[model samples]
Target: MKQKRFGIDIDGTVTCPTSLIPFINKDFSLNITLDDIKKYDLSEALDIPAERCQDWFNEREPDIYWSSPLAEGAKDVLLKWKEQFQLFFISARRSHLLDLTQKWFETKDILYDRIELIGSHDKIKAAKQHKVDIFFEDKHDNAVSIHEELRIPVLLFNTPYNQDPVPSGVIRVDNWAQAEQWVKAWIDSESFIQQ
Candidate 1:
């Protein structure tokens, strides 16, 4: 069984999708559940003015990043994957947040081969540069692009924000458990094909 390189996204992929809801509810004094988040931008989904959202984000982004809870089963599955795959995290978070990201990874005891905070959701270049055999993503567009451009498999963690359609190579998974199973299947089929 040869090792593979996997490109993963942060935010809703590795962190719980509802991680920001509590903070938003606290800040806005509005009770909104994870179900209310239909778009990737909180401003758009919450109906908050973009400038206000930007200001709020600028003020609280660090705290938000620091306090984000890991996705269910993410640590366990990732720890297992670490032994057989090179984990490369490609996040849209600003490059300056590397320290916070690394600290969070340490706290969660998740190891990775590399982490890229590209300050944008466009991840095709990074995925290509890393030569990832597969990608795990939460963004609908990014997932579609990575798969279509790279001609590789992508496990898209399902979220309300990314409910758009995807191509054949993009698989929608609800949790890390499904992601693990899908990856295992891909690897098994890949091995069979290679032989």
Candidate 2:
């Protein structure tokens, strides 16, 4: 069977972002918790423009793109998937973080065909442009938007902040190991059998 294209997210989905939370709270002094950051509605922070929040992050942790830790089994699962799919990283990390993100990939030895750093909140447009059949993301808003607008399958990697209600047709998985199995099973099922 022919390989499929996979569009994956960077933050919590690929690399764990927990390590950066402390820096975010310390630098911003917003009394924000990890949950607050995860479910943050940038529009609601009237005192800070959404874009300025990105700047705040850059100022405090310029190397966040490279410093974020990988989730357990992330490297192994991704490397395995790379052999079977055209892996493309679709991240909301600011475009300026590209160099650091690349450095992280190099450090972990994670291979990919392409990496697209989408700084804006809007991810549906990027998914449509890429013709991504399946997306693995941690953000509820992004998953909802992409799945609804493009009718593409989105596997929402579970997180504390996103534990509430989920949009229709979006599947949630606990971790990368389970996610990898779910994806492989779906691809191997008789329903997807090729002629």
lDDT of 1 at 33: 92
lDDT of 2 by residue, 1-195 (tens): 556878898888888847666666666675665556545454343256778875776675556656778988899999998987888899877788788888889998999988898887687777777777799988888888888887877899887667767776688998889988888788877345663
Root-mean-square deviation of every model = 1.0, 2.9
Tens digit of per-residue lDDT, candidate 1, span 1-195: 557999999898898988888889999999889888999888999999999999998898899989999999999999999998899999999999999999999999999999999998889999999999999998889899899999999999998899988888999999999999998898889999999
Clashing pairs in 1: none
Show model 2 residue runs off by greater than 4 Å: 28-38, 42-55, 190-192
Worst lDDT 10-window in candidate 1: 1-10
How accurate locally, in lDDT, is each candidate?
0.92, 0.78
Using TM-score as the measure, the top candidate is: 1
For model 2, state the Cα shift of residue 123 in Å.
1.9
In candidate 2, list every pair of residues with a backbone clash. none
